[model samples]
Structure formats: structure tokens, C-alpha cells
Target: MVEAVMLWNEPNNLSHWDFKIDPDWKKFAEMAIAAGKAIRSVNPELPIVLGGISPIDPNFIQLMGSHGILNAVDVVAIHGFPLDWNHWNVNEWPAKVDEIRAVTKLPVWISEVGASSFGAEEVQLFGLQRMSELLLGNVERIHWYSLFDLPASWTATTRHKEAEGSAYYRHYYMGLLREDETPKMAAAEFPEGLGICQWFHYEDHRLDSAVEWLHRLKVRYLRTGVSWADSHRENAELWFDRQMKALEPFNTTLTLCFTPEHLGIAPHYTSPPKDPNTFAEFAQWAVSRYAPAPVRTNSAYAMPEEMAAPSVLR
Candidate 1:
């Protein structure tokens, strides 16, 4: 086929300039699989090559594994940029190390990536070789991201500019050759950007990570301006609403509200005169009194009140 026997899927690419970034890799991978299906329809026997610059999106891995397609790809690829996706659009790289290895249990490849830029030629080569060892040893099949001094237009550098024979500025000069495609000292050490090494041994996969992700929300997001009991209660409610999407995907809700015995308010509306400030204070009291009877961390975060007979709110 004009597109080659199989497609080189650049999951990380958007265009020559636009590189798509998906915060949720699983959903993004779903789309990728759908797209792959559409492509395969064009050439039934043709296999798909995934991971061109994809760099291991966890969400993507979950999607791929959930389906039975881990081995469906002809050549799996990796893009190891070694930074967060926000910085180098490659955050998924580190996290996806395991995912790629697992997927490569079938077939995997590295369509692109390299080492340090603006550093000596060896640094660039070293990064590529290091990642190559980890990936190659897993499945024994991969085409490294690249192997030559591609110009700045595609790779972004100017090693070719010195004219005084300074050898490493071709931006992606990981190839053991010159910009003219001539052989350099590194050319024969690796061939076609492919090599093999030991299977990866990452640090202990943290089990039941006790890392405190849900930090106690300080009263900081709650503006402590003019308020009474109601305001504090309402602030807690507001904070809950603001943070629910992050806190609860399985389930969550604002089940209660508070007021003084004489206020004659419902156990729901902590708004209007009853702003977030009042809500916070009310929540502090609620947790202090009726919070599940458990010794939660001394966190100053809770619902302004709990559901109970209207008289208890008083």
C-alpha cells in the first residue's frame, strides 16, 4: 500500500505542528482504536503500528487492555520524551513504562524519541540507547524513533549550521552520521535505531499508596469575610460543590445544611445570606459532633451539617 503495508500510528501527533494531548488516556485510546478499525477496513490484512510518539498514556493502556487487542498491533511504538506532558507533551511516558512493556508482550516498537537536546551528541545518543534497552528486551522488536540528524524544520536544532564541522547540531542527530547522511562514529554502534538490552526493572509498584492525595482543604478557598453561622455552613457547601467532581466519581452529594435553632431554615440551602464562610464553620461543628464517629485526620473539611431531624439542626 502507498501508506506502507501497515500504518505508522503517531498517537501523539495532531499535525506537523499540532500534537494532540488527551488528559484521559483510556478514552483517547478508545478513539484511537476506532480510528485504527477504520484504517484496517481500507486494508484488511494490513496491521496497525501504534505508539508513534504516544509515550504510554495510562488511560490508553486501560482501554487497550480492557479490550483484547494488546496483541492486535503489528508493531507497538514508544515515544520517550522524559517529562510531563505539559512540559514536553510526554508526561505519559514515565507512567506508561509498564503499560508499554505489558502491551509489548505481543508486539511493540518505538516510532520516535531521543535524548538531550542542546547538549553534546553523546547525551542525545545515551538517552535513546537507555530507553532502547528497556523496551527492546521486552518484545525484541522495535524501530527507534529516529537515527539521523534531521534538520530543524522537523526536529528543531542547528548543528548543521556551524559549517566549521561541529558534529552534533542537527537537532536529532542521534544517527551515527552527518546531516548529509554520511556515517559518523555512532552509525555502526546501533543500526536503524534498533537495539536490545535487559527487560525493565522499575521501582516497587506502590501498592495501596498511603500517599495522602486528599489533603484537607484549607479554609483558604473559603473566603472568610462577613458571615455568621449560616455563612460558614454555606461555604462548606460551596466548597463541596466545587470539589465534588474531583472527589467523587463513584458517588457524592451535599446531603445537609445548617442553621441556628431560631433561624428556621431548611437543612439544604446554605446560600444567599448563608455564604461559604458560614458553611465552613457549620461544617467544622458538624464534623466535630456527628461525623461517622471515626477519628479522621484533623482536617477542617466537612459538610456544613448532616441530615437529621430538623430539631437537631437547631
Candidate 2:
């Protein structure tokens, strides 16, 4: 049984992709409400989280609330990126979380928060520590953006072409560790009780080292993904078995995200499934295979039927 489900991640920050429609708040709120209702119907006890909007925008929460999004979900989430996107001042984060809480009158979560090592590792470490201290009591949870930096080759291959020319390139170094799996200063200084977001595509041999590092950091919660495309590929079950085996020793709570690919959707991975039944079936298989004590699927575009399908709960 999954503990909580976040509908999407950073929906307000669509600058990284080229979307077919104008990314408006109204549409986003409507989608969130529908997805929340569906998730609640399937697992009445599970928490339904509104995806974090980026750059600490309180007005977005207000806009979503106006559309009844506040009533649809149990938690309001926000990304705490105090260093990037011209938000250099770290002092503003507490007030930002407070602002959102005031509007939504719900538990606030800093779902995606981290400072990239764009300038210096020490600077990134300092910013991360300060942000954690400030956010300690203000929010329900804080998940660091990443655990390992994306390998340059992996970034080049996976990122959309438009991302190549922008500041998005800096994301390659956002992890607490470099691509080679060595720890950075931020890894050592990561506050206790906070969660981390790690990429799910690590090689088999690398899992032990990754777990070792996570153990050293005293990490308790791990947010990772299960890709629909990967599951359908050759030898998929074998691959998942290995990953799960590697992860078992750590005994960390898992938040497994479901990411199904839809062909016609722009930017590849961000699109919702055209066939809800197929997506629900795939989600069921993933849940049964991992049987993660708590699973979390990500998407703002998930249809209500897709979430409520009997296949998803079984």
C-alpha cells in the first residue's frame, strides 16, 4: 500500500519543455482536482498531494484554491529552490512556505528542494543546510532534488533538445554525489529526517555503493521511479528484481513513482497515457512486483478513471 501520491512535480515550471498548449493555472488546478478525487476513491486512506509548484509561488496556490483544488487534496506542495532561477536569497524561503500555508490552510510539503553545484560544492552545501534549518518546522517534509548527478552522456541522451541551450544544463550537477558516486559536501551535511530523490536508472553494480552512501547520510526516505517503458522492454522483470534486491538491505521507506510514456505527448516522458486502462494495468503490475510498503505515482494529467480503476488498487 502506497502511503501518499503526488499528482505531479513542479507543474508551474514548464520552461524546460515546449508544450502544445499554453500552460495556464486554471487547467492545472482542474487536472489536479480530478486526479486527487480519483486517487482518493481508489485508496481512501492514502494521502493525495498537490504537486509542488516551483520558485516558491504562493499566488499559484491561491489560483489553484480558487478552482477548489484545496478541497481536492490533503496536502499543498512547493519546490524550495532558493538558489536557482534568479532566487539567490535564502532568507525568503520560510515566508514563502508560510504564505502558501495561509492560502491553502493545509499541511505544506517542500517536495523538491535543493541547490545545484553550479558555482562551488561548499556553497551548495551551505545553502542546503540553511534551507533545511529554516524549513525544519515550517513544512511537513523536505525532499532533496537528487542523490547522484546525471552522467553527462545520460543527460545528453535523455534531456529534450531545447534543454541543451538553456541553464538547464546545470541540473547535471545537482546531485549530492557526482556521476562517479563519490559524495559531495551536501551529502554529508544533509539534514536528518529529510528525504532524497534519486534517479532510478543506476547500473546493477552501482547499487551497493549507492546504498552505502545513503546509509552514511542516514537517509530514511527514498523517492525513485518505475518507468512503464523500461518495464515493457526485454528482461524487464529481471532488471527490477536486481534493483529491488539491492535496495532491500537499506530498509529505507520507498516512494516509487509511476512514469508511463505516451508517444504523441511532447517532451516524451511528461505526457499522460492515451489509454487509461493500459496505464492502470501497468500500474497494477508495478505495485504487485515491488509491493513497496508505500508507492507514489506521479502525473498531473492522470484521468480520474485511470486512478480509480480496480486494476490500480489490486
Query: Highest lDDT, which number?
Result: 2
Compared with the true structure, all predictions reach lDDT values of 0.35, 0.63
What total of clashing residue pairs does each candidate reach? 28, 2
lDDT (10s digit) by residue, model 1, range 130-242:
65555545543443323334544443322234552433343344443444545444334453325211100012121111011112111011100111233344344343333
Rate residue 164 of model 2 by lDDT: 55
How much does candidate 1 score in TM-score?
A: 0.40
lDDT minimum window of 10 residues, candidate 2: 305-314
Error of 1 at 15 (Å): 6.5
Ten-residue segment with the worst summed lDDT in candidate 1?
217-226
Best by TM-score: 2
Q: 254 in model 2: Cα distance from truth in Å?
A: 6.8
> Which residue pairs clash in candidate 2?
2-294, 2-295
